[model samples]
Target: MGNGYLRFAALGDSTTVGLGDPLPGGGWRGWARLLVESLQASYDVSFCNVALSGATAAVVREQQLDQALAHRPDLASLLVGVNDTLRSTWDPDRLHADLDHVAGALVDGGATLLTVRWHDHAALLGLPRVLVRPMAERITRVNEVYDDLHATYGGLRLDLALMPEVTDRTCWSIDRFHPSELGHRALARAWAERLCAAGLDFPLPSLEAGGGREPSWRRDVAWMVTEGAPWFGRRARDLGPWAVRRALAAAR
Candidate 1:
């Protein structure tokens, strides 16, 4: 595995798409790309990332799963379920079923699957106090799904929730949802470390040195006004009503 060529594919939502950490030439350089670059230092690696912002688990299963499978990747990463957690109609069991299918298929295809437990974003996002517990519960349940799948199939799992640095303000973008550049670097380093610990040898750098440029307040403010506000408005128009209806149904 180490000497041969490697194909890697990443599938998920906004985080995997790297919303906060934009590339100078456009698009994003998320943790998936960083991990791939690290591996590229040694192995002949070809990488593909098919992640979309605002994508739910079902959407990922429907859209990206087939593409990832077609790539016949030797290594695959799945980082979904956050968008599902945000929805009012979220069903952890259903989400788990979809993810189980994805994991099962990739493993059956002989790909080494990798996935991470979601961090508690609600706490850092400054959500209304009333919404925090519910959101936290949803996140916990989703992570349990990841854990269960990993236990059933041999794969690597990183518990980002337990990592305190992930919750720090510096680690997040102005939107408070996506990771900042520094945060992305932290994630990449973590993944590399985890992979190495799991016995896959690769040249990984120290977390402290060569961290990317720090985001400035001016850029942050500009992004909030330009991108964040529009994103919030879209979510309100599209997702809010659907979520409300689902919440109401659940209450009934």
Candidate 2:
């Protein structure tokens, strides 16, 4: 029935496409996929991922935004701006404008929005930390803009860069710039919790306080922007929500 179905699309950059954690399966399992499997049972969800590996806000403004909109989804997610900051050699103002433009496009597309946070951790990763912190702050400024737009439009927004769980070096990618596989799982779990708190009523794993667990979905989201595929669908593979209910029943 229409009541049980949801169409979702993802638009952004490398993280959205799963560049940080490449799998041998030939498909990069990112956070969006985690989201897909998480909701597959409760909602007859169709997912379209149109994220590029090195997209800037400008690139998204020009290209992928249209592709995502074409999917006609009810739920849409974006994870852009890192490349905008990392590659902006012309003007900072332009980068900020690009952010606005892309967000505007998604809004126009009539999809509920979710924005990922930006971060830099070379310092925590044992690098000199001189590289991307300033860039990260500029990213922070842009994320604030994203926040305003989401609030104004009545949507969800967050920043992955300032997340506490990601301070540990283990969360960084092998290159120390992206998030690791573990980081992706944490991200998916967090976002599920966010949607739940927002009255989404989706299935989610319990957060354990001994490991920084709380009602705070923000911490998990802060760990990684990308969600890997292998980590998702673990509990709900093959079986329906009835299977999930059965598992819960057995646990009791």
Question: How high is the CA lDDT of each candidate model?
Answer: 0.80, 0.63
lDDT of 1 at 39: 86
Residues 1-252, candidate 1: write the lDDT tens digits. Answer: 445588988999988898777776666787787788788787789888998888888988899999999989888888899888776678888999999999999898878888988888778777655456677888999989998998998788778877776768777788988987777778888888887897777787444524344456897799899988887676556556665655677688
Cα displacement (angstroms), candidate 2, residue 187, comes to 1.1
Q: List runs of model 2 lying over 4 Å from the truth.
A: 88-90, 121-133, 205-252
lDDT string for model 2 (1-252, tens) is 136877788888877786544455445676677667778757788889988877777788788877888888777787776555543242457766776776677677777788765555334445223333544465666667666666666566656755776786655564455655556656767778787787666776333212222223453354344443322233124223444454466568
Quick one: best lDDT, which candidate? 1
Q: Clashing residue pairs, candidate 2?
A: 29-228, 29-229, 30-227, 31-227, 117-159, 117-160
Model 1: residues with Cα > 4 Å off, grouped in runs = 205-214, 233-252
